[model samples]
Target chain A: MLPLRVKSMPADRKGIRVDLQLVADMIEPGTRVLDVGCGDGTLLDYLVHFRQVDGRGLELSPDGVHACISAGLPVIQGDADTDLKDYPDDAYDYVVLSQTLQAMYAPKAVLTHLLRIGRRAIISFPNFAYWRVRLYLFLWGRMPRNETLPYTWYETPNIHFCSILDFLELCREMGIVIERSHVLDSWGVPRMMGRSRFLANLFGVQAVFLLRKSG
Target chain B: MGVTERKSTGQAPTSLDGTGPIPGYHVRLGCDSPLRLDCGVELFDFPTAYQTYGRLNADKSNAVLVCHALTGDQFVADAHPVTGKPGWWEMMVGAGKVLDTDRFYVICANILGGCMGTIGPREVNPATGKAWGLSFPVITIADMVRAQAMLIDHLGIDRLFAVVGGSLGGMQVLEWAASYPQRLYTAIPIATALLHTAQNIAFHEVGRQAIMADPDWCGGDYLDQGKRPLRGLAVARMAAHITYLSESALHQKFGRKLQDRKAFTYGFDADFQVESYLRYQGSIFVDRFDANSYLYITRAMDYFDLVESHGGPTKLFRNTPVRFCIVSFTGDWLYPTPENQKIVHALNAVAANVSFAEVVSDKGHDAFLLDEPDFHRVLTGFISGAWERRQGHAAAQG
Candidate 1:
């Protein structure tokens, strides 16, 4: 037998094309993966099948669970708002929060849980510091609703929004370590994602960072 | 552990072995023999009429079990038996497709309550020398999964690559995870909820009432009368079918489309196109399905609530060490995305590994049964991913 991981990788490789390369570069073989707010099990699926990582995902929808089940993918039906406490400390190789930080009620608590439960954590989200959002606030003086934040003010699910600079500041305050970082476009094309950390406050549109708890 | 329980690998592998036999039909493995339902009803030596298009690898690590919804047969990607129509999910399962049978061993079964070639009210009871009728002991979704687990065991497969289903079939998938998490590497539940909410129960009750109200239905003894509960079952189907559609979809498809008459008919003869379409659907369904099975099955679904069964807040799987992926459709008012969201929230409470997707479609609860490209893509990706995880674990041991 070629091994289970190799057999499962090719299908997953087809879906997470761009992200697959990125995950392969970042993750080592045999790592345990926990992905919160995993949409359709895409990233976790990629990491597990392609990068030889063990995957667990948290998603809060039935249809999502259904598709996941039909595909024979493993996942849990859950929300990041309240489900973070279920994990034991230092149980995972990595905890990942991807594109979900801005929608949280308590991003800090979630990040703390990730660091506590895993050796390292990956956090990614749209940057509220994006130039379009800045222009909307600066020129139109509105809450800056665009493609990422399309819903009306009353209906938006995003209760809190933070920029890359704001998130890094929080990390610094908590004495966290940034192992690696990435930024991507809407199409998930990686660019100068972590360049100019100091100026990322005004110019960064997306951010992905690896964090570890301060010892 | 016993000699009889050993897998019969020498048996002539049929279409049920998880491979598609013909075009437009995706095949998966089915038990070469019959299954036993919790109702003490042996499927009376029935064949698990399934089709698979993929090859089961030597270690059986590529197997993915597909559970069908209510009214769904095992012919997931082939022509329908009676209607001669295309398979329900031909788009999602095929060679080189998202659920590509060429890659993974996909297995689908006609659920116990189904009108298909599986044991139901239509099948004769071995002890009684007559159809089981309403005499069949009621079955829960857990019972359905239990039966499925038996089929999986029969194949010499130690663990399923994944378990996937929609609607009632989705219920079985969830139950499989809850009751036997160790057996499945992953679970994908689409368009199903952890519980049957009050509103859903009410809808089911209405359908039931419509079935029993017919004069032909002699309480539970009408099967011997040679007149199946056709009128009642048709009406039941018609009423329940409306809930499967969204208001937006209904409005777009059949809003005030007049029948083949310029003027309104004074009599109640299906005055509108919507009315005629519904009538056609109901009448057609009655021909292919057994009415008593419908009653027993819907009752089972009505009582299904995973949280309630788990005693409260279904995060019992926090330590189960399995993964999940949940899919929902925007227009599926039957199970609704909110119900799926509730499940996700609960899994989140336990910090379990899970994923969520709300595919944008007007197909309602039936979307999972259709040619949804997005659904196929996500599912194919997830299964391979779970397999890889198992492989990595194996590698570490070496």
Candidate 2:
């Protein structure tokens, strides 16, 4: 067989999003990783290429799954809410679920399954309690529409939107330890959310947390 | 098993136990070992007709077995000898197509109860030197898969990279996943059901009764009596053909249009273009297909229920290492999306690596057999990704 052309991961290593790159940086090299809701598998491509990790993905939509396959990524078409229970305990080193927590049917159950399926689970979601969102509700008395949370309430797929504090509380209740965290502004630029968790919860547009079992 | 590696010799190396690498040729296996059938009968020296394309790699991990549908044959990407038409899947199994004969060793075989060169009702019985006819022991999807496993063994390959099929062929693929999960790395079952639905079985029964009612059928002994049940077989084909197509397709192609004329004849002639089309389909089918084979194969398909005797579908893939890609079409009411979804859910419950694609096509159950662009893209993407992953795994192990 001839050499395979590595796609998803470009040679320049500049294609990945900043938030995704932060998550990638936290993952150790040569580990098995599963990316839940991995759309187009861009992060997986980057991980497989640079980090030399065995990467797999679970995407719900057909287009995303096909795109991932087109990029030669081993991604399966499955829902995060219901399908996570099938995975054996600690089957992966790192299971990453980015920007898909809000749309889940049962966020807590999915988060619990994630903690059990991988040694560490990385999750990123838009914080509904951000200052801009809070002000939009306080002043206009309607659901906030922004770059990340663009959908109206009637048409929104985010059935269980949560804030950074809500997520942390659930993690605490589940006895999951937050190993690392990154906060991004509305523009996806990493902000000081890492330094002060309180201010981050109040102002950060997005939050990414690296979590593990709190033994 | 002898390893006949013909490196750069430009000839198929012959194995000591089995015939050489006969690509594009069908091998009639005289099964030295008895094949115990699901019907509790053992077939002694049954034949399995198969065709192959591309070269088997040195490691033999790139072999893909393409199972054919109820009426399909071993000609995956070649011109059918009788019909002179392009192979059934010519669009997806050629040089640059999804299966990509250039990259993988592609093998397709006529099933055990099939008429096209494989052992069927028409074949002469080794015991009595007469056509097996109704004497042929009833076979199931599992039996067909067991026969294919023997062929794979004869080819001296330990594991198949993939097993792929649609409809009844998909049943065989599922059977392979259940019976010999270790022998396959990936399984793609498209536009198929886990078992024959009541409605589907009703359809098959209607078709079967059409063949049986004909006096020419002569109690399944038409061959000895020098008779052909063309009328009955044609009727069966015509009735079953409707199920293969969707109402929307029918409406689009020939929506009450008169055949060969703008005005209706009002006679018993094929006034609607759809009738003429169905008649044409039935007439052509009888020319190439055997009536008795139709009876046996449809009976086998009707008898198919994977979970019941197999200890449920989840158990089938409980610890399976195989990955699956299940596809269903929107307009395919024969198997439907819900049927495919059931299999997908089972695989999910077992934590088996699986994917499901509900392709939007108005072509009905035959969508898998058609050249739908989305279907092609999905298949190509899945196979390519699987190949790359297999390569990565091998390289990592090294």
Candidate 3:
């Protein structure tokens, strides 16, 4: 497994309209998508309905599969860390791993799998090193208890946590080009998505990276 | 007990020392009731069962109830009792998956008129100590929905995150929205329609008639005689199963091809592979499902006309607030895309935030349950997006 290209979502931001807007722009009519770790197939369903994007997903849950199936969607019972290797090279236009990277045992391997199977990959994850999380750890010594990461340490599923700078550096080292990016706060507000990268790294916690596979 | 008598009791599952293998609630019912048929007859008791998964969150905001289709049980995410198979929707609902057991508290109950664990013709009538076969009130799909509502109420879930299902499950999801809109955050109905068309009813009628025609059906009284209408039920399953698939899928899977042979035998026996396959499907179905229960359940499906029941198509979504995701498959003729489109159109007219997708697949209505990649893409995106929206709102609040 390679080092993960991971970034944390920002803190103290609000507004869901930004994410929807980004999703609307990222996909076009008739584009094919593969959403890895899709929670319940909502975005995939929405994109397909509104943008006419043909989409598929890989989720490890039967409830999600049932929801997907009930929506007449398709999915495979595979994990991002191990199962993604089976997909043929460049089989999809976009392989998306949204809010699922943190749960993986090998985030880099998963990202590489996404890159190998699709032309471009969209990766989204909640930032664990945001200002609020940092404050909690610095002051309380207890694991962060923000709304984004709500579970206790014993039950929490987020394993691989990274900062914005760390993710950008990994992408650069891997020679992967960032085609588009969405830097959102914990509240989902886009503070510096389509603008300056330096400001995004300093303030933006939640980050969405759209990268093209270099290798 | 005699070996024959013990066989009839539906001994406990050997997997978990009678506790059963499951992630949550699991229930099993013996074939105790003599089931009654809508065609004025009866059959001995058949195994009807169900189970529940996930914990009901304290706030109950996480409770989502899943309704199964005809011949489906409450075991949506577990193993089936009689068939010894995994739950029908195990692909979508599980820990760490879309319907994350960690997030939402889920409940799945047997439908009211089902032979499953819920009260139905399969349950023994206390007064007569016999299956209520044929003598049971002819049930409608709405009745099934009503029963599900009762189960939800019993479970203390006031509002459901969503009522989601495909095929017959889809039908119930629609009914839940129309009947109890305020209690739902979302409604996901797949591979179903707003109303059962004349053609759909006619097809169900044909299947019911075929089951009733079986001599062993004994006017729905085969239970007392310890016999089953195996031939009739198998034929019924055969006919109904055909409707579940598209011509293209049939052609791709099993054309006018021969079965395990170089040439046709030219005998009355099954020479074509399709014939043999259908026969096997029919025969295996009889071992698990009861003939009379099939007739009753089909009758219930035929009576599912939400538009007609709601008084008119326009009035149905007049006050609907539940977000909807109605999906249809290109090749599903039984519950065609047009049917789902009608649902989408109605929801749109009512000013609902409804999303719909019609995926192209040759698997027909059953495609909703298969390994279709496009299907998962839309679903995974929808559910997680919903969660993200919720999380986003929380983040903005404080």
Top of the candidates by DockQ: 2
> Per-residue alpha-carbon lDDT of model 3 for A9-86, expressed as tens digits?
232222223554565567657887888876567667777777777677666664565566455554443456765664
Cα error, candidate 3, residue B357 (Å): 0.6
Q: Supply the TM-score for candidate 2.
A: 0.86
What does the lDDT read for residue B278 in candidate 3?
93
Arranged by TM-score, best first: 2, 1, 3
- What is the C-alpha DockQ of each candidate? 0.22, 0.34, 0.02
What lDDT tens digits, residue by residue, belong to model 2 across residues B236-301? 999999999999998999898888887877799998889999999999998778888888899899
Could you estimate the TM-score for every candidate? 0.70, 0.86, 0.60
lDDT scores of the candidates, listed in order = 0.71, 0.82, 0.70
CAPRI verdict on model 2? acceptable
- Candidate 2, lDDT over the whole model: 0.82
Candidate 1 matches the true fold with a TM-score of 0.70
User: Which is superior by DockQ, 1 or 2?
Assistant: 2
lDDT of 1 by residue, B111-196 (tens): 66555545566655668887677877787787677666766775678888788888887888888888888888888888999999
**Best TM-score among the predictions, by candidate number:** 2
- Write candidate 2's Cα lDDT for A58-107 as tens digits: 88777777777667676777778877776777878999988788878898
> How much is the lDDT of residue B169 in candidate 1?
78
